[model samples]
Each structure stands twice: as C-alpha cells, then as structure tokens.
Target: MNGVSLQGLRVFLAVVESGSVSGAGRALGISQPAVSGHLHSLEKRFGVALLDRDRPIAPTRAGEKLAGHARRVLAATRELEEEMVRQRAPGGTLAVGASTTPAETIVPGAVARLAAECPEVSPRVRVGDTEDTLAALLRREVEVALVGQEPEDARLEARFVEEDRLTAVVRTGDGKLPEVTVEELSRASFVLRERGSATRRAVERTLRAAGVEPKIAAEIGSNAAVAGAVAAGAGVGVLPERALPRSPGVEPLRVKGLGFTRPLVLVTERGRRLSPAASAFIEVCLNRDGR
Candidate 1:
C-alpha cells in the first residue's frame, strides 16, 4: 500500500515469527503497546484484519499473503544493499601503503593485476619505510599495506606473502667482488638503509649475530638510493635481492656465512573490513598466477 512502511512490515514479521505481541515487542526491542500500535496502524493502512488475537496470536489468510510479500521485499532490499556495496567497492578509489622494497618490486604487479580485474578502481599508493607504512595503516590513511616485516601492533593483522633476502652490493670496479665472509663485511664501509627500514634491520641483525658490527658509512632512505650510493663507490650497500638494479656500475656479492632474509607481509588493520578492490589486490599479491 502507498502508506505502508518497512517498519510496519518488520514488526509484522517479528510478530509472525515470535507468535505473540509481547514476544514481538521483546524481539524488536519495543514495548508491547508500541508493537500493538504498529500492528493496528499496518492493518488500518491495508484495510484488513491481519492477525487473529487468540490465546496465541495467529495470522489470518490476508496476513499470510502479506507476510509472504514482506519476506520477498525484505530479501530483495537486502540484495539491493549488498549489490550497491559491491558496486561502490570496485568503482571507488582504494588507498594502499607499501614499504620501500615491496613498493618497488611487489606493488606494481599487484596494481597491474587489479587494473586488469577492475578498471574502475583507482588505486592510490603511498611508499614509505616499514614503520611509516604501519603508521599509515593505523591512521586509516590506507586500506592495506605491503610491508617487509610483520607488524607487532595488536590492532594489525599480517599475512606472509613472500620471502626476500638482502644482498651485499658493491661497485663494479671494486676488485672483482666475489663471495665474501662476514669478517670481510665488518671491515667494509656499508651504505645501508635508514634505521626504520626492514632491510636495514635484517642486515644489522645478521651482522650482529655474527659478532661483527658493520661500519655504517651512509644511511640512505630508499633501496634505490642505497644502490646508487654503492655504484658511486660510497660504500658496500645492503639491499633486497630483487631491488638490485641491473646497472653496469653495481654488482651484487653474496656473503658466505650471512643470510639476511625477511618476510614480505600483507598487513591490514585487525577487525576492519576491507573493500572488494583491496581484497582483490591482496589475492593478486598472494597468488603467483594473479587468480
């Protein structure tokens, strides 16, 4: 009917399901008088006696027909709302934060896959160190993050995406760099990533475990910067293996006793529901085939 409200239909369904006016009030969190008022209003609007108020309430033939229609209407309304949410997810902008290594090596492929799957979703990416990326997540500046290390915050969830190792890089003319030992690394001046970088942390931890403190010559911000510094003979730089560009002036050398590896993690705020675009991008990052 023109005057019929969804609220009246909801109360009708509650009464039908609960089998009593008092039970409907309890289920709908309203008073018994309010429930009765709603039912009276609904019956007046439809010009039909909907319920037979006996010892236990029962719907009349007209009430049964209206109840069936109410169920279908509610279901269709729910489906419409869900479809709207799905449409907004793929058409809206998705913000993502990424640590330096993954920002350079991993995020591009995932973004490409997302573009192929959902062209309408415009992904905005912010690149920073591990700590900065986590901060961005906490501030809700980004919906998801690809970080080099697992976040320790209780409010964050991390999933392992892949593993990456740090390689010792030196200048191409640096005496035909071969496999070197940890002892040799200790003596060399290292152009390492800045303090908050996951790659720098892994490199320093490995060096400390070997009882050799690396001589820090230059502390750079990004992996690309570290590679550039090494090529210019600033010092030996430690960077993710995949981050080492195939430039003529730089060469990657393996350390014999040192293995610097870190987990590449996909991080999201715990208990936060991700949009469909963000979820799809995560699937691309985790699955090798981008499925």
Candidate 2:
C-alpha cells in the first residue's frame, strides 16, 4: 500500500509463509512483537484484513496479490544494488587493438604515459594487422584501437594520431643507393609485411601504379622481424620509419613516385561513451588542446 514500508511487506510475507509470528520473527531476525506490529501497520495502511489470526496464520486474497508485488520489488532492489557496485568499482581493465607499426611506435609510449597518469588502471594490448584489428573492434573485443589506416565503418569514430609514410629499409653496406624509382624498386626482390597490413597495402598500390610486379620474398608478422630480414640482406622491406632500430646496419631509402601516406587513427565505437581513463588516454594520443 501507499505508506507501507518494504520491511512491513517482508514481515507480512514471512508471517504468512511461516504460519506464526514467533517463527516469522526468528526468520527475519526480529522479535515476535516487532513482527506483529509491522503486520498491523501494513494492514492499517492498505485498509484491508490481510490475514486470519487463528491456530495457524493464513493470508487473505489481498495479501496474496501484495506478496507477488513484494517479490518483484525485492528482485529489482537486488539488481539495483549490483549495478551500483559495478559502477563504483575502480580501475577496470581496458582491452585495446593496434596494427603493427603503430603498435610498435605509439602504443607503448601512450601506455607508459597512461600508466603514469592512471596508476590504478590495468591495460591489455593486442597487436594485429589492419584487418584483424578492425575485426576485433567490430567484435567488441577491444574498446579502442590504434590502427595504421583510418576506419571507414559508420559504427566507428576515429581521430587522426599521425601521418604514416611507407619507406624501404635496406642494409647499410649493400651498396643499394638511396632514392630509387618506384618501378626499379618494384623490380627488385622485396620482403613485404604480411597481407592485410596497412604498410603492405600502400606499397602494393604504389607498385601497381608504377606498372611493376613486386617479387615479395617473405611476409613477416612484426615490423622488427621485417627490418631484421632486410638487414640480413633478404630484401628491401616496406615499412614505417619509426619501426627501424637506430643502428648502422639499417638505412631508409626514398622511392620516387611512391609517395603514399596513410593516417594512423585512434578509433572507438560510435555512440558508446568512453570511461574517464580511456577518454583521457585517447586525448593524450591525440594531444588535443596540447596539454
């Protein structure tokens, strides 16, 4: 009824189920007099005789209907309590995906900065090629992605982190001079990154445009692996400059007519709001407001 408390409803239900005030009080951790008082208050508020006080307590028709509502109310209360606890929990784990180049370059730096900023949060970073990262994003396995190319899906929103340009890295003493034309480079043996990689896709387009078929020697997983293979004189590999280790064995070569650049994007699902920590990490990557 309008003025009856939840405790009053519990007492009424317990008394009906137990068939006696003393038994209901023991079940509810209250005295027999307290249980009787709550039952009386509930009946007075509803202006109805809810039970018969005889040898064994029994509920009237109105009490049965109120009991059904009380169960639903109790269930809803439990759900609300669980939801509130989940919201208040701190430092939830965040899952993220990245393409190889950006994963090697920016992700580690961003994660380090994020760790300093949000010490309580724990991060789980997954590395993949372009298509795999996008697949992870679409599947909701990762809350955010650092991708080599911008995502075109309407379900994703992206911010440009940096412009990524493809370069050919070769061994230093191999006598392969810098500034080779696209056609000549395409004719040479090439150690390409794996298929579905953004760097590989861009390099393939440039080779096709120059009307030359590239002889791909190998398809490697990480940028470091590709660079290592190239350093061992396997072949010139198409990769990002940031992926190359600062050593004498490796040197980046420029290719004429192969000036292709794709944007590195920080992407998240559309219409899904980010947590404060996730949003802050994205903002740091974007460097929005230059803070």
Candidate 3:
C-alpha cells in the first residue's frame, strides 16, 4: 500500500475535481462513505494529509501534486482502454472457419453482427467439413474455428459454445410420412457428409443405438450437397434444421429414436490464446440464438 493504487488515485482525483466527498461519490458511482474511506486510506498510505475533509473537501498542497499525477495516469489509462477497444472492434479482417452446417446458418449471422458493431473489421470465412476446420486450427490457419463436438487432440482447447438438435431431412414430398421409426430411417437411403465430420459421426452413432445400421448411400462433403441429394430423392439425411437452405427441394422431418444431437465448439490452441479481435468474434459466435 506504500505505492498508491490506481483505484486510490482515481478516488483522490475525483474528490479533488468534484470538491466534495458526496460529489466525488456521485461521479465515481460510489457511496460518500466509501469516498471518505478511500481518502483516509490514501492519506495513511502516503503518510501525508492529502485532503481538507471538513466542509468543502479540497486537496492540500501534497494532495494537489498527487492529484495532478493521478489525472495524468487516469487520462493515459483511459486512452489505453479506448485504444484496446478499437483494436477489438470488428473493422479488421479475421480468419475464421466453420464446419458445413454452422458455417451456413450460425456463422453468417454472427459475422453480420460483428460487421455491424465494428465496421472496420471484416472476416474471411472458410467453409469446410469438421476435419478441415480442426486442421486449420492446428495449423494456425485461422484465428477461430466453429465445429461440432471436438477433436480428441490435446493440443487444442475446445469450448462448448453452442448446441444444435439433429433432424432428419427428407424430400419435401416425403415430409408427411407419419412419425417414422429409426428402423425406417435406417432402411431409407441416406445421404451423409464425408467421413471425419462430427455430425456424421453423431448420426451414425444414433442409428447404431437403434440396432439399425444406416444405409448411407452417398458421402457428400457439404451440407448443401447432402441437402441437394436428399432433395433430388437420392436419400434422406440427418442435419440441423438451421443449416437448411431456402430452397424448395428438401424438408426437415422430426423422427423418433433419432437420438442425434451434438454440441458445437469454439476452439483455439491450448496455450496459444486468441487475439483480442478473435476473442471478440468468439464471443459473438457464442451469443448466437439457439438453433
């Protein structure tokens, strides 16, 4: 306590500038008693009477000197804070990646919000399968990655940022097919993402639980491709409803025994923390509406 704390200095400055403990408390959003306590603490720490606390609280001679330095420190700190905020604003370009589904539905809106909040920050988004997104994070290719589940590698730290319910996407014509059984889904021709996709893994696992082996006919690389295949009556697929495109071809149908839901993650290297801008973007992504 020999060296005055910034908080103490700030209190000191507020009191000096406002010329009253009550006034200083109002300015600092603190109680008047708290302001008095800080003044006493500062005086005891510096071993000098810093304020005339009788009627109109004014800084003594030593208090004036300390007040001046406090103003400079506080002013400089304010400038630094403002600059940090600017650096965090989304006006600059951020490298980001997402798996097929979230990239289409969740990320675009999050990016738009970031863009609006920080006009200076632009994001370069890459759409890929989950494996690609995880690989990019490992290679330091992107600042942030949004993907389902997470890779098992210890080099990366995965955070559960979002959750999406899995749905059976059927041809619009088949949408009315009454509550279908998991066995029925297993028998239906299935379009799925390429191997290594977390969503595909969840779909497979859910089918396995039902004692039904999924008859996956096509291994598509993207959600769009899978949706297209299902729309073309190639096969039905499991996907998140949010990722569905605004086309007339396919419809998401709810099915029983399809225990296929997965959490989405935001990942970065274990020790390598994100840049301020990247961190801000991660926050924006986490703030997305539940899908």
Judging by lDDT against the true structure, name the best candidate. 1
lDDT of 2 by residue, 118-213 (tens): 776678999999889988988999889998877778898888898987677787776466588766776678888888898888888777777878
RMSD of each: 9.1, 9.9, 7.7
By lDDT: ranked, best first? 1, 3, 2
**For model 2, how many clashes?**
0
Q: Would you list the rank order by TM-score, best first?
A: 1, 3, 2
User: What are the clashing pairs of model 1?
Assistant: none
| Clash tally for model 3 | 5
lDDT of 1 by residue, 21-83 (tens): 999999989999999998999999889999988858889999999999999998998999999
Model 3 agreement with the true structure over 1-291: per-residue lDDT tens digits: 576678888888888888888898899899988888888888898899998877777888999899888889989999999998776554567899888777877787898878776667778888888888889988889988888887689898887876788788888878786688776666788899899798899888877877878887899887777888888998888877676666458887777755578888888888886666687688787776633
Off by over 4 Å in 2: 1-90, 246-248, 288-291
Better of 1 and 2 by TM-score: 1
TM-score of decoy 3: 0.67
> Which segments of model 3 are wrong by more than 4 Å?
1-91, 245-247, 289-291
